[model samples]
Structure formats: structure tokens, C-alpha cells
Target: MSKNIVIIGASRGIGKELVQLFANNEGNHIIALSRNVEAMSEFDHLKNVTYKAFDLSSSTVLEDLTQILSEIKSVDILINNAGKLVNKPFLELTKADIESCYQTNAIGVMLSTQVVVPKMLNKGGHIVNISTMGAFQGSVKFPGLSAYSTSKAGLVSFTELFAEEFKETKIKMNCLCLGAVQTEMLEEAFPGFQAPLSAKSMALYIHDFALNGHKYMNGKILPVSLSTP
Candidate 1:
């Protein structure tokens, strides 16, 4: 059956790859949401795909969602990949930066999923939260990664908690703790940090995950890294 998929933070990175991957499949209807729709212009030529640009932090998220969703009947999958991270020393990190990270990475994901999960209840759905591998092992010494790691950690927790809340539903939840990827976010966060996974490879992983990972993967944090060992 054709599936309606909602992808938040779809302008770039893993989200962008998902837009491309899902678009390749004829049965998928994709809704790509980001703060700037222009970033997704590459997919403009594709059919069965729609775009929405809005600040997830804005108070109008619910209202904006209602308007957009009123036109669509349902979504079979929700990918919360929108996130912000600031790499700075604990002392140098500003209150605004910390709060912004939490809001975007953790709170924004929670609120956005809340808007979509109910629509999926009648027909079991999958919710994939894009997190970071930094949350897996302690990164206190990873240089200026305090805020980033913490927010991802919070996201992992949120995924576990939310999964428990839906015990009665066929819907499932999982966290994709992605490792370094060649994305603007990586460049901006690590400047010159080299990654083993290219955006294309990352996108492929997302496609496979959505197609098969959700079947036996719920309430778990899955890591995607470059190392072969």
C-alpha cells in the first residue's frame, strides 16, 4: 500500500536523503518540513511530495500542522530529524544555546510527533527520531560537545518514554543515533571533522531502516557509524 510519510527537518542532511529515497518509491507520499523550503528545491521536480516551511519552535506549530494536515488523510511514518547543536565549552555555552538545542532536538521532536502519531493509530506507524552517536558513549572529553550530547541523550530518553506510552497501539518508535556525516551541520559543528558516511550513504541507510528496521526495532537506540570494525 502507498504510505504517507512525514519528515521533519527535511531541508538537509539525513532528512534530505530520506526525501530523495522515499520519493524514488511510487507508493510513498512525502511531506517534507523545514524552516526553509528553498533548501529542498532539488526535489521540486518530484511528484507525490509536498513541502512546508515553519519554525518548529514557534507557538504556531500546532495551528500550522492542523492546516497542512487537514488536507491529508493520514501518515504512516513520522521522522523527527530536525535538530540544532552547539559545540562550545560548558562555561562558554550561553543559556540561549542550551535552551535552543533542547527545544529543537528534544522538545520540538516530542511536540511534532504528538501531532502525527494519533493520525497513525488506526493503521500502525513508525516514528524514527534522529539522534547522535555521541549520546551512546560518554563524550565529556570530545571538546565543546556538551550541549550537543546532552540534547541527544534527552532525545534517546524521550524516545524510550514515548514508546512506553503507546503500548496499546501498533505504532512503534526508535532512535537513529547517527554518527559523523558529511552535512552542513557536521561542518558547522566540527569545522573539519571528517566523516566516513557521506550524505548519500546515510540516505541509503535511512531507506533500508524505514523499510525493514521498524519491524523488530522499537524502544531502542540504533547507531549508524562509519567504522568497519
Candidate 2:
């Protein structure tokens, strides 16, 4: 059976690898969405994969996504992997920095889900939110990640709340707070730091989880990391 899978932030890093992993199955139709359409050209050869320009930070996120959602028959799985990282000192952060982080990492994800929820309403689906270990309670914190981590924390809350709200239905939601992964995004936040895992390795795990994790858990916030607490 072919499943309709949507992967946001599909231009590079873990999201890009995720598209590759899922598309490898051949039976899965992968919808790759991101603000950078040109960066997604690598997926052009995959017959089962499609790319679109999606800006989560835009004020019209809901409207834009609503239009996209209508063209799809149903979404079997949705991976909210988009994020914004502003590595400014707490005092130096500007309003734009804060807003962009929250909009892309948190609020935008919520509104995007609002548009896609209808597609999953009948047959049900899984929504996996990708967050950061910085947002995990009692975890070690970073000095310049106040805005980034706080915004991701909002996603942590959304996963739990959305799961509880839709418990009676077949829909399920969960959050994964990741540690350091070797990627462009990591370099922006932690320059010269070598993460224990690569984006391809992390995406491998997420690919499997998005398919089966819902059977065992809902509203669960699991930490996927090699970092110490």
C-alpha cells in the first residue's frame, strides 16, 4: 500500500535525508516542502517524491497550506522537521529573531497542522514534531539558544496537547527532542562542534518511528540523543 507522507524542511539536513529514506521504499509518496525549492532539486529523480515551496514563517502559512492540502487525498504521516536557530546572546536577541523562531518552530507548525488535520481525519495518521534536547526539562542548556530552545519547547507542549485532544480518534502525535546531529543547522548553533550522529543516521530512526511508533505511544515526548542530561 502506498502511503502519503509529508516532510517539511525538506531542503537539507535531516529532512532531506528523511525524504530519501522514505522514498526508497517506492510505495511511499513523499511530499517535500520547504522555503528553499532549489535546494530540493536533488529529489527530482525520485518518481515517488514531489517538492513544493512552503514557508512556515510566512503570515499566510495557513492559507498557503490549506491550498496544498486540498490537492492531496490524505496524509498518512506528517513530519514537522522545520526549525529556525538564532545563536545570539540572550540580551542581544531582536524581536525578529524571536518571532521567526516561534513562527517556524512552533506556531507555524501548529497552523500547518490545522490545515492538514482534515486529510487525516477519516483514516487517521501520525504527526511527529522534531525538537531539540535544549527544550527537554532538566537537560543541559546552551547559552545562546534561549530563543531557539524556547520556541521548540512550544512544540513539545503542542504534541502533548494535540494528542490528548484527539485521543478518541485514530490520529496520534508525539515529539522527539534531538541532541547534536551533524548538519548545517548544528553548525549555525554550535560551530566547530562534531555531533555524535549524522543527519542520515537520525533520519533513519525517524523514518521507522513515523511508520510504527504511533501504535505504542501517543502524546509522548521522547528524547533522541547521545548527550548527557
Candidate 3:
């Protein structure tokens, strides 16, 4: 059966790919979100894709989303792919930087799920959070990533907790602890560095993961990294 899926942070990067991949399928319906909806309007040409302008940081904004979602009925998959990263030295980071990271990466995912999960109750579904490998292991003076790492770690923990809550249900939750992927955010952060994985590749992998991932994975962190051999 075709499923209803919503991907947060669908303007670009991994989120964008998820929208494209899922919406392309005749069986799935995709609702994509981001601040710059124009960037994703190209996707509107697809029959199953819907674009919305949204920022996960605002509680009031989510209140509005809840109402909109009620009309959509239910979603079979929820991909929390929206996130922010600040790669400065820990000492160089400011309060705002840390807060923004936590707000987007940690709080955003948690709240967004809260709004979407009820729809999946009777039917069961999958929730995949885009996290970072940095959370699993300490980095080498990469600086400024403390907030990003911490937020992802929190997300990882949340996945476990969420899965436990649904132990009686068919609903499943997991986190994709990504390594360096060739996305605009990566280029902006590293400048000259080359990422081993492309957004297209990551998207394809994630698409498959979302479909079959729930079968083998629940409340576990799946890491995708170029450094892993």
C-alpha cells in the first residue's frame, strides 16, 4: 500500500533527497518543509509532493502544523532530517550558537515527532532521525562541534526512549548517525574538504532504509561514514 510520509527540513541536503525519492514513488505521498520553500518548489511538479515553509524552532508554528496534520489524517513515515551544525572551537562558540543547534537538531525532532506520531498509532510507521557519527565517538579537536555532537547524542537517546514507548505497537524508531555527506552544509563547514558520500547516494540509502529499515532496526543508531572500512 502507498504510505503517507513527511520529511522535516526538506529544502536541501538529505531531506531534499528523501522528498524526491519518496514522492517519485507512485505509492507514497510526501510533505516537505523548510524555511525557504522556493528552493523546493521545483518539486511541486511531482504529483505526490507538497511543499511548506516552516521553522521547527517556534512552538506556535508547530501548533499550526498540528491542525494541518489532523486534516491529512495520518502518516506512515516520519523523517526528522532538519538540523544545524556549528563547527567552531568550543571556547569560540556563543550561547546563541549552542541554543540554535539544540533547538533545531534536538528539540525540533522531539517536538515534530510528538505532532506526527499519533497519526501512525493504529497503522504503525517508521521514524528516522538524521543524526551524526560524532555523537558516538569524540572528535579530534574539530572544535565548535560540541553543540552539534551533543544535540545528536540527545537525538540518539530520544530514539531509544521513543522506541521503548511504542514497544506494544508496530511503530518503529531509529537514528541515522551520518558521517560526512556532500551537502551544502558540509561544503560550507569544511570549505575545501571533499565528502565521500553524495546527497543522491545518501538519499537512496535512506529511502531503502526507511522502507526495510524498520524490519531489522529499532532504537539503534545506524552509522554511515566514509571513514568506516
Query: Clashes in candidate 1: how many?
Result: 0
Q: How well does candidate 3 score on lDDT at residue 15?
A: 88
List of clashing residue pairs for candidate 1 = none
Q: Cα RMSDs of all predictions?
A: 1.8, 0.7, 1.5
Comparing candidate 1 with candidate 3, which one achieves the higher TM-score? 3
By lDDT, rank the candidates, best first.
2, 3, 1
Best by lDDT: 2
Clashes of each: 0, 0, 2
Q: Please, what are the lDDT tens digits per residue for candidate 1 over residues 1-229?
A: 6899998889988889889889888889999999888887878898978988866777677777767777777788888888897988889999988988887888777777878877988988888888888887653237687887888899899889988999778888889888788889989977887888888899898777876777887788887776411
Residue by residue across 1-229, what tens digits does model 3's lDDT show? 7999988889988888889889877878888888898899889688888788878777665685686576688889998898888888888889999998999899877888888888999898999998888876553335568988898889999999999988899899999888889999998888988888899999999999998899898998887877543
Candidate with better lDDT, 1 vs 2: 2
Overall local distance difference test of candidate 3: 0.86
- Give the C-alpha lDDT of model 1: 0.83
List TM-scores for all candidates, in order.
0.94, 0.98, 0.95
